[model samples]
Target: MPLIYAKDGAVATFTIDNGKVNVFTPEMHRELHEALQDFVADPMIRVGIMTGAEGRSFCAGDDIKTPLPDLTPHEALEAHFFPHIHEGRTGLTRPGWEQDVMRFKRLKPIIGAVDGYCLGQGLIYLLLLTDIRLATPEAEFGFPEIAYGMAGAGGMTRLAALIPQAVAMEMLLLGERIPADRALSAHLINRVVERTGLMAEARAMAERIAGHPPVAVRLEMEVTERALDMTRDQAVDYAATLFRFQRVAYQGYGAGTGFFGTKHEAAE
Candidate 1:
């Protein structure tokens, strides 16, 4: 199995194990989609951790060795128009698989444990999918696709949103690898630690997140992501509505206990 998924308590771990650098393949993407579906559906799993099996790389990127079938102009148009119809077609190249994975709408948070190279599609995953990230001092982050004459728009948009526009442009345009410290300075990753303590640190962060109230955590994730595109007034209104809804649900279940106190206790 190129992708290994395991659940321990409230934390689900996804380990990419293809080759030494853990480059992604179509099969691995399929496996990841299924595993992610399961992870989202399982209410017991509150948080997720994504890492590479070997210490060499979290994921270098897609496997360029896999041959893509040549499509006629009409076939390309058809595939682009009706993606679901051509989804199962063998030998057909499925572009935007990473985008699909990132757009899964899973409210649960994922922590990225980056050890070595996090480049190309790997960098996309790190930027969009993972809420929190920890990398080793040896980790290198970049988007090398520009050099290959292919730049992923989704990655570019997310990268620009994550860090400063100038820094993001420098990375996208130069196609040069940035070390862990540089990445940290750019605010791309949370922390850089020794390789020995990477997973331990990631797991500890995951455990801390999992210990929080599940509904609150989900709402926090959902609202924060949604608020990014919302106007200030709209975001405030939306957050207030969700907060009231959550409070009502909790009170209906006779579980109004909060960080402060229950409504009745507060009234007293």
Candidate 2:
């Protein structure tokens, strides 16, 4: 299997299993979307951890060796205009990139556990989507699409919001690999651990998140992402509204109360 999904307690894990570099093939992309769909559907799942199979790489991005679909201009236009006409070749009505972006939005607290060689779209996997990113010291962060005369789509779109414009521009324009230390210094990743301890750290973090009240965690994710576009005053009002909603909907469950009504449950 190029992609594997497994669950342990409240935490779901998705592993990219293509050997060594774990390049994203077309099938892998499809599988990823399916895995995320399953994750979203599984009510037991509260968090997800995405990592490459035990190897020196998280993912090296797309496999350039895979041959591109040979579609003529008219066929391509027709495929774009009427997806059902070319559903067999294209797999779905929506492009994989858009599907992936939506999948990312739906998954709560998806953690990217990068070990090595997180490049191109692989880097975007962390930058744009993942809520928490942890990497090993030997990990590499780069956007090498420029070398192939291609431009990145998702990563470039959201990079400036996550990191400084100058730094994001450097990575996008230069097509150079930055070391994990540099990435950490630039605040691109949350933490960098030794290679041997990388998965342990990531799993520990995921377990901690899973142990939290799922509703509160998800609400925090929703508010943070949505608040990015809101003005400060608007965000403050929105957050207050969410606070009331949480208290009402969750019965003050996550307001630091204890299990079995041991701790004082705040009155509504």
Candidate 3:
């Protein structure tokens, strides 16, 4: 009827619970945004996972038709949808709906456990909202906002920043739904899994990330975000001194750095 948003330890999941298609309504958006805000604020939560109930959809996008009139007024207002129409755009911040899509500067990473039929704003959010996108082989991604006579403002710009130019053009102009394998090949998705093990693999990934030094990862993301807008030389100069950072050494912040003080740092 509406939607479900729940948090468990370092993982918070936002599920599209409005029937099979998972249409984005106002309430659904509000609930999801609030849950994400909570996850972002929680020092104990290091990862967030997004999923849907069942069938071929993480979310099918906005409701194309009006709600059924047979039910009471409350039925028509059961869910709070925002992606389609909200304070995220036009510089407007409605009650309980903050500008999250562009301000997900949380202390943790958000991961999307993508499965079938991720379309329109759903794909847009997956492209920008999630730091890591792990898709099932059965998953498909698209942006059909143009077909609805509206521009996919977020996906239009964010997809290009995330993926190559050609792939971004294909998604923006042609309006085709790309499969998971294709998406992975284009670097649109980070990992691909068999449909049968999608959730398990995603949870495992979340757990692995959650087990790492939380503050380091958070600062890494934040610093890199700042670096993205800097000149190459400037970014390089800044990175030279990044290793001296010791704020993450506080008690309870230990991921032990493994053999090298941090998973990401070791990788570097």
TM-score of each: 0.90, 0.87, 0.77
Model 2 residue pairs with clashes = none
Q: Best candidate, lDDT-wise?
A: 1
- Residue 16, model 1: Cα distance from true site in angstroms: 0.7
The window of 10 residues in a row where model 3 has the poorest summed lDDT is 90-99
Q: Give the TM-score of candidate 3.
A: 0.77
In Å, residue 115's CA in model 2 sits off its true spot by: 1.1
Q: Total clashing residue pairs per candidate?
A: 0, 0, 10
**lDDT score of residue 199 within candidate 2:** 78
lDDT for model 2, please: 0.76
What tens digits encode model 2's per-residue C-alpha lDDT throughout 68-130?
566678877876656446657655443344345434558378889998799976777666657
Local error of candidate 2 at residue 266 (angstroms): 16
Clashes of 2: 0
Order candidates by lDDT, high to low: 1, 2, 3
RMSD (CA, Å), candidate 2 to true, equals 3.9
Residue pairs clashing, model 1: none
Candidate 2: where is the Cα deviation over 4 Å? Answer: 79-85, 89-104, 154-157, 252-268
Q: Give model 3 RMSD, 1 decimal.
A: 6.9
Q: How much is 205 displaced in model 3, in angstroms?
A: 0.8
Report the number of the highest-TM-score candidate. Answer: 1
Error of 1 at 6 (Å): 1.1
